[model samples]
Target: MSDTPIEFKDFIRIIGRGQRAGRTLTMLEAEQAMSMIINGQATAEQKGAFLMLLRVREETPEELTGFSQAFRAHTPTSITELSVDLDMGCYAGKRRHLPWFLLAVMLLAKNGKRVFLHGTHEPDSKRLYLKEVLPQIGFEVAQTPDQAKVALDTLGFAYMDLKHINPQLDGIIQLREQFGLRSCANTLARMLNPSNAAHSLQGIFHRKIDVKHRETAALLNDANVLCFRGEGGEVEFNPLRDVTLHLSRSAQQSSEEVKATCETFITKPQELDAKQLISIWNGELDDTYANYGVVGTLSLMLVLVDKLDWNVAYQQAQQMWQGRDKTWPVALPKYNLAAETFDTTGKHYAH
Candidate 1:
């Protein structure tokens, strides 16, 4: 190797050159660039410019793939002891509605599905984020990967903030407050899949992000991924609107538009409370919107886990919700096959 060194300015120059001269970074270059940033080799101004320049245009799959590779290389923690079924990314907090998706995840966990979720702590944002919402229920936010593993072992679910997962990246993600626009940090965070789970569920708000995420997942060789335009960019399906679900399985991409099954949409509650999630799950609170949102989102997740058709999955989701163990985390039980499995289909998930 030559006794020469490269600087972060070179990366910024490649992307931030005048419109005609600028071009995207190659996969290798993207990886190196992100590695520098992650290692604190890049200046604050250089990092901001690089991110915003790429954000000005659409982020290419190669860039996302390389960024994700660099991120995973630095993140060595993994729940090797547990087989994680789903990796849920929750960077975009919900604004229009309560996070019904949390209930769906809780129901699946209660019925014995191991899920690992990572999200950002957007302190300045007006929306409600998972970091604050999770504790209101019975769940506690994991401060480290070991804590996350422990949660998965007992609760069948766990959530860690991006700050704990990678404080450097979280610091860059927080730049959104100053930039007034989201950077690629959000996208890179979504693709981490730190536990290397079998399936990944992602939600996006913009028009073509689902496609972008699918392509990036294929580049990363993720086994299965479900990307969709979700409610306020959380992985909760809007039951009142027809939604198109983008899918990537074994690097083959496809999409299907599912019709809206629920006819009514509820206005945002005056006060968003986590106790309501428990109430809805326990049948104490009869919320039409919450019911459809939970069941619909659960049906989508089931499609990822069981590979069932949407209709069949929706039906199964309803059944799962009805038979849920009302008391969870307090008297958590071992995986019960009879309770978790459906009698109609002989397909038993022995996991």
Candidate 2:
């Protein structure tokens, strides 16, 4: 409870003793270890060693659960009070495709389901992050939890950057650049649903991570969670590939994995300009491939949320798309450096 920093040696020794000598941290140990790091008790060397050792040994579901618990403890209660039907984790930047899920989340918000989508992208990321793309549509990524609540109250949805969620968590996540590879931070961050939403959707780049996410969600007793290998590990459903759904569905507060398949609807990913997301949403452009991408993703999320049956969800997704609001914010003459300026200086905002 003191501001004086404690060196991270005690926590590091638990997981980095020696080859075959070091042991995995128990759930309690992991949580305590994470607390120390988040509290700035860990030295830089110990932080890197702890993360690297965990990566080498591979992270267990229990470790991930503890990591997430530590994160949720830090989430501001104001953001948690806002009603979020779904908590979407979008840390994985999309490389080959634009984030169609952005439009999907917006449409779901329009349909009266409050959503809290949050994440951060690497500075050296080759992909376009939602931070950059959301701005084009006049949406400001919330810089703080209170601002996130405002975005939801006024815009019907919220996109929060990782820095706002927990600066310490964000600090560790940024270390990916120095580590030369991702660590457990990416996995645990994706599983963090700070608002305690009943339903969550995770998009993993690898199939193996799908199992870890579902397992961790079940341990957390989440009412519903769906993790699948998505296009570039983002929540967008790829029409070009068969999606293996890794799910955790709860009944009577108990959760279990329910695996399913989403058969590929198209032969390949569509070749379209990424900027067309604007026209696609406004109904000015109608490409069959893109249309299927949007509707299919919506259906999957709907089914994941237990809002509709499989067949009914697909049908309703199409209808929802047809009646979407087409009113557009007047295109800004130039993009601005600050996103928070959206609410005050913009000509218009989502009604």
Candidate 3:
């Protein structure tokens, strides 16, 4: 690769060393390194090397913030201009359960909340993907920024795929199949918040990421961010697992959760089935755990908005779940990204 940031060694100097000798990229340094990758300045070898090196060391909050900033620079600035209540990111497809979270977002939409949900399905994943399910259920996904606004004006909600929103980040997210591990793009996608929505919620598979989401959003000065370790990493809850919500607002950070004075609900992960989402919403399935999952997930979002106390929010969530209309008529065809040996950037690997 032609060197821009440093003429000598460039990207490798950050990771091409023994553990003690290696260094993490500073905010600007990381942003510069990412610019090379996204701008097609880095060679394939450098891309792979850079991604794996950071994966081995793990990413820090500043590193995430820097990388995210570089990514945002490449994206259209107008996306953040749109106003929405919550920015919901759904990247990790659920492996062990139906997406109770999708229903919760839709319910909020049903009740006059503007929500923007975005995600991409992994090319090789067997998990129940929201990308496919949303379409399967007859929900139209916005392919462009303008279309997303239309959906919001009309339906009060919209689902967008990263493919259209920012193909650069989408390309990196698909790198998991090549590297067999996540890169900074995974974290980048969660922090996209394209609309710069005043409030945002993210779910992570790792406890550490739960904390990073709050810290980095605080750095970005996001008005409010609520993050927790989610079921299979999608912004849904496992009734059985205790949740610690890391919250960020006004540059101050704190951890919060519904006080749980009531009998806390619990459940084992259910078997995979997208159709189960419809049945559960219609109350035909009669699954105790699934019902509680939806209510608890909604309760968390209600608490995040702060219009009501935790107890009142919990009760409202319960009422919404009970009163949810059964005739939403959503259906899904299993969607697996059409197989591509190369990443979306069209960079071929020596397979």
Candidate 4:
């Protein structure tokens, strides 16, 4: 209750008050608060304080749903016309290993699933991003919604950077560097599901965040939402670690703990090479550990996509991997022969 006009500070006060008296924002309040920030109505100080306060506390499902709703309201609705079957969010870059979940995405695409992948061009220098790896693996990143439509229509998969999808949200996401810590922007971005897809896959770095995402999915009445603790917080499951999946399907929330498929941990390579993505897909690299990561993630996605039993899904994923077209993009109908090798600099360089 400051003497000055209420404005955004009202939200700041609600969440920033002493822990004893502080309260979570209701869905409508959170939505309105986020709308103010997104519409540039909140001052820089108010924005920083609001984000940091939410970051320090575990954001409630209502707050997440509200924030995401505000963001989705501003994004383009054109992608919905394409009827993307799966919505995958990638924000956290990989540090421990290559993003094996990407292989799972490609596998789904190869099997005729329309997938829309969205992520920020994260500024983290220590990690590997999808934008960087996609090109190295012979896939180009989409710069706009129209380009994404083309990719999805032709390849059954597309990765659009968050900046293009919603620049205001991406700007807030980039504030992580300035704050020296991640804020709720990252979590809210993952929850956008701009395409209004029936299924969504999200990876969380913290278990508490997983709960928030699960509960939020239920509140949003999402058809199928899967949240898991992914490798380096990217949506790729680590088969070596037992994974607890938080799911919200048909507006009901539940959880499942899938046992690790193996006991041995793969040794981290000294230098990261993304080109191995293609080699492994081509059957030139027989990497047991990498294969496990891919199959493990694919099985989890099957649970999301088809509602299959975990064990049965694992078996089916193995079979799918084994039967995969080794020649890959060459066999793909829209994969251009000239753009066989995409460069990391966002340029298409011919072989």
Candidates' C-alpha lDDT? 0.80, 0.74, 0.75, 0.82
Q: What TM-score does candidate 4 reach?
A: 0.91
lDDT of 3 at 170: 92
Work out the TM-score per prediction.
0.89, 0.84, 0.86, 0.91
Query: Least lDDT summed over 10 consecutive residues: which range in candidate 4?
Result: 342-351
C-alpha lDDT of residue 184 in model 1: 84
| lDDT of candidate 4 over 1-351, digit per residue (tens) | 434545888898899897888899999889889999988899999999999988888688899899988988898877666688999889887765777788888898999889999897555435667887776666778987888888988888999888888899999988866887777888888888888898999998876778888999999898999999887788887877888899999789999989989787577665557767778999999887789989988998899999998999999999999999888583322333233332233221110
Instruction: Tell me how far the alpha carbon of residue 55 in candidate 3 is from the true structure, in angstroms, after superposition.
Output: 0.0
lDDT of 1 by residue, 160-270 (tens): 887777777788788877987778888888878877889899988778888899998888778999999888777888898888988889888888889987887466555
RMSD of each: 8.8, 7.1, 6.1, 5.5
lDDT leaderboard ranking:
4, 1, 3, 2
**Which candidate leads in TM-score?**
4
For model 4, the local distance difference test gives 0.82
Clashing residue pairs, candidate 2? none
Task: Rank the models by TM-score, top first.
Answer: 4, 1, 3, 2
